[model samples]
Target: MSINAKSADHSPIDEDAEQLARLGYTYEKQFKREMSFWGNVSLGFTYLSPVVGVYTLFASSLGLGGPPMIWSFLIVGVGQFFVALVFGEIVSNYPVAGGIYPWARRLWGRKWGWMTGWVYLIALLTTIAGVAYGAGTFLDALVGAEASTASTIVCAIVMILLATGINLGGTKLLNKVAMLGLIAELSGALVVGIWLLVVARQHDLSVLFNSFGAGGGSNYFIAFAAAALIGIYQYYGFEACGDVAEEVPNPGIRIPKAMRMTIYIGGFAATFVCLSLILAVPDYAAVISGQDTDPVGTVLSGAFGAVGYRVVLGIVLISFVSCVMSLQAAASRLSYSMARDRMLPASKLLAHFQEKRHVPPYSLLLACVVPILVILGSIVSPDALVVIVSFAALGIYLGFQLVVLAALRARLKGWKPSGAFQLGKWGVPVNIAALTWGVLGITNMVWPRTPDSPWFVNYLVLLSAVAVVGVGLIYLFAKKPYTHSDAPAADAVPPSGSNRSVAENAQSHHVENYL
Candidate 1:
């Protein structure tokens, strides 16, 4: 049971060890071990909840109608396929702690890489706020707690604190907690979806195709585009799997496989949810006019009654909590890795680890703190949170777009993966398509409406632009550069001395506080 004992059980470096030896620290790796393949898949699915998928389906139905919204998923899928392919290449080649940011840095340059990382971090943090905000609304609706800002903000802070605590134990605990949450959520969604589809008669497919304003919009494409954004939202967190390269066993193969499986499973689950909602329009108007509080539960209550509705609401809360875990894990690790490389401030503190838990404790604390502050700040201005959500979504698109472009740029530069999960010859084309689609999405986010415009989406554009530029400036001046030597080889470092960089002994630095 001794920390240094290299026996099969005590060794920190193992197929399942959550805190791997390769992680630099005098602290022995003592957290829970890595997940089994099935465990990983389940965790990923939970983080990417299908309940949200149905929510998106209804949103799209309102704007673009059911048929067009489905088409939007297909369209976004194709675009994301390219990005995924490109990610496949980079991850396969250099699966490490820092993912897209490092990939961008390696393929592009230090300046650009930092820019990518900074924007991605901002986006992620912003999205975390959105999730917390949404979860607060759901919590209020399901339990009928005091619906005041005080209650919502406290609830959000508690959720973030819980996620941080789970992650402070390292990846294994995070995965296990996340898996359990996802299972509860997904099971509830599956039940609702199947029940709805079975009980209701199929609607006219052609009617959905032709209904221009099914949700009350005039233009079909605009409505579909808006709704499509919702469907795509459910698939957003899969990229987090790659961010944990330092912990994933045989990351070269495993990370890519996990990424692919995450998308496939998440996509399939989402599609099922979308289909069920489309078929089970027990009350389409009610679903579309969904409130910030317990919208999905409201729809379920109408269809399945109070008992059934409560169960679904419970599942939705589980899903939200699971998502919070996933985001916290990804965001904190990103901070740890970035700070470890001197890319963020106070590297020493953010990168510190607890020997018993074998985790970046400071990073977790800081991450939890900032988001709570953000939530509290939201109490003063509700609309500000909406702007934050849009900004965060835009940040993901911007960062990923560069990563996709980098993948293409790398391929064009003649770089290739030396392992499994190749996108074959289709890699380059797929990446290009992903870039184009991602860009289009970012554009929509930026200019959702115009001042003189008919629809009220112009402010979205202005807000997104301000967010991008504002965040970009911080990266340009504040963050440090990542060197070529900073790019650690995939699986190059072994257990005991694994964390040693090409430059020197792995420096004792603190991780960032990004929750």
Candidate 2:
């Protein structure tokens, strides 16, 4: 566990090990650094899967805000890029396994990290269930099987089991599948988008600006804000890159670059796909007026004929499987990271890693089981499932903003980022912008827009956020899990003016002050 001269070795693998050692943890040889830069990017891109995002939200977005809702991609994309930059800075410095948990722990304190991870962990589980359920609907379509609540739930459980099996194969298999997913998904998106734009265009370019009375009068911004969920949900898959930091060589340098690549590339693909779908819609009035509840299917079926539409459906299914696999992998890693620190109940079991496969078996199983339970719980009321799934995007943003807030707090406390990729003077402004955008985005998402629905349904997002945080706080104080860990805390090192490296500073300070 001690840093030696080898810690100074400049080779990527050695440097990564050295970096982990510097962070007060021994290098875990179980996690071989098998993911290359592109593999890392693929995990993130597939997780972000433009196909999944657009297809899932398209009808609702179009109904709520018309063609102009497409702009949410650009707006949320820009804002998330700022968030990605903030993440890149933190991951460059920490390069730890858990994306937000370890980053928050190092930046703030143990309790802050626990709450952030708790909320994010629930969000990830909810997202897995949501994605799996969506995939089941597509699976039904591709197979020409009748879609029903029972059938979709069965298909979703199958998808979850399949993803779990693949994930248990370890990071190497995860990397290969992620890369393949990236190729299939990206190519499918490009092909479908180009075909729709060139061969099936029903509306002119200016159609994007037309809202078709979507705002219910002169309050278009209200509608636009509601539709922004399309982008908010799509842009977050970038952080999956850092979730497996130990499995990527030169993580401090490579992971940051991979993160930015996910945003830049994923954003463009999502926007292009959204735009093409918008232009290809044969009748915007029908979509806006609720006459066409399934515009995506209508467009694909009309433009591609029966056989070609089925072919596209197959590609979409692949994207969904890839997305589910990537999400499960990330969820397991986060679980493992937290459990390794003895943060969660049954920590020892959850933290157990398979020596030969370099995988956290219990953690992976936990990830798989939780989502299936969630899916099964929804059988009584399918609408209840939708309400729970709706909290996914908001929960993710809250987790992200907590990290951003932690970074800002660390910065104000005179902590300078000393990673391979520091933002230098630009750090503060970028952090501020990211935080501001996150607050606005969260507010927009939680706003009770549906007047006709029950009050609980409209305020579900806010209520869910408060409920999750409230539970976490109650547990935090009642059990005081943070006190059990010997891991380094926020005050382990002096402020930025210190000449010594964080590793050296941490080595000198006693690990104390849990309260």
**Clashing residue pairs in candidate 2, if any?**
none
Off by over 4 Å in 1: 1-33, 56-67, 200-207, 215-218, 283-298, 450-457, 478-515
Clash count list over all predictions: 21, 0
Over the stretch 70-131, how does candidate 1's per-residue lDDT look in tens digits?
66666666566556666766665555565787677656666767777877877777767777
Best by lDDT: 2
TM for every model, in the order presented, reads 0.82, 0.95
1-515 in candidate 2: lDDT tens per residue?
32222344355576567668768779354588999899999999999999999999999999899999989999999899999999998887788898999999988989998999999998999999999988877878888888888888898899889989988998899999999999999999999999999999988978789898887785899998888789988999899999999999877778888999999999999999999999999888898889999999999999999899999999998898899999998899999999988889899999898988999999999889998988997778877787778778899999999999999988877776766677878889999999999999999988999899999988988988888889999989998889889886674235567755464453332211110
Clashes in predicted model 2: 0
lDDT of 1 at 206: 58
Question: Over 4 Å off in model 2, which ranges?
Answer: 1-11, 27-29, 491-515
lDDT of each: 0.63, 0.87
RMSD, one per candidate, in order = 7.2, 4.3
In model 1, which range of ten residues has the least summed lDDT? 506-515
